[model samples]
Target: MADSQRTSEPINIVHQDEIWKAHVKLEKDSAEVWPRKWGFLTDIYKEYKMESVKMKETLKVGLPSHEVVPSLTTLQKHNHVGPSPPVPQTTQALIGWRSGHAHLQLEKYSTVHHGRRSFLKELGWPFDACY
Candidate 1:
């Protein structure tokens, strides 16, 4: 019994020693890794702050100030000589040149796809037969 207890005590002590070593190794690794991660994050944050400041400075220098730019009423008075032309009430005028181009494209698509379907109709086939 004395010999058996002595053998079992050494095994338990070795197991406890292994668990203590693992705990210490984990603490040391955590201590080593976190500082490097925090340092890298700090550097990135500093760079971002510097870039933001540079962008703000560039914007401040590039954009015209309120005092330098002419107001809307001042521009209107200078541009118009006498009476202004009447504004058109049509939707085409409101949409401008893009509307004319869109209308022409629609007409072309209809002529190609819908207007030329008579051949398929005469042959007793579906309109999408070619497709």
Candidate 2:
């Protein structure tokens, strides 16, 4: 091939060493800044814990300790019902709605991961077209 059209050669050992050194320096700099960058998250977590404690105290005062929380079986007994009529139109409509919502969520995820389809497929997504 002509020199102008030739592909570039791989980096030499000296150049690779320099690149490694630069990467190490960059990593060290980032490590130094990482704590400062994420320090607010720690503060926020502390505030959240304090607020949760205050809420728990408020709840304890407002609600009776004898109140019985509903069991899952009780809730399921009240909520579970017989299967719906096997109406083709209604089934298709519900599937469409669910697929549309799933697609929208996948679009948002794709902006970050750029592998939403493969990720969903790996998770064994039921609706192939949604991803």
Candidate 3:
């Protein structure tokens, strides 16, 4: 493949935090004050949409290898997210685990997996509405 044919795609080089952080402040305050629990599900759906965009960006760039936290490379797996190994004494490892779980959840609930047969039967969502 020649370099000339390469498309000028804007790769997201920053981390997921940066991506989500940049646009989070622009959201309007929730107005569903009554019931409190009333429509929190809708708000969650909105959040999922935003995170979905960022995740897609991260996916496009591909996860980078980190020297400071070498094991972070493990999170790049498509089906990542499981219990961390025993003896997680460092904060970095915990943070990595959280990040991996969050990413996996986004995918589990994304429109990309909206309707096909799934092994994750417990996570089944209504086929009519989704992120």
Task: Tell me the tens digit of each residue's lDDT in model 2 across 37-101.
Answer: 99899899999999999999888765455787778998998864454444446665666453354
Ranking by lDDT: 1, 2, 3
Error of 3 at 22 (Å): 48
TM-score of each model, paired residue for residue? 0.24, 0.36, 0.19
Q: Which stretches of candidate 2 lie over 4 Å from their true place?
A: 1-11, 61-131
Model 1 residue 12 lDDT score? 74
Candidate 3 regions exceeding 4 Å error are: 1-37, 61-131
Candidate 1 has which clashing residue pairs, if any? none
* Candidate topping lDDT: 1
Q: What are the per-residue Cα lDDT tens digits for candidate 1 across 29-113?
A: 9989997777788888999999999999888765467658888999998764443344568866765434345433435445554
Q: What does candidate 2 score on TM?
A: 0.36
User: What lDDT does the true structure give each of the candidates?
Assistant: 0.73, 0.71, 0.62
Report the C-alpha displacement of residue 48, candidate 3, in angstroms: 0.9
For candidate 2, give the lDDT: 0.71
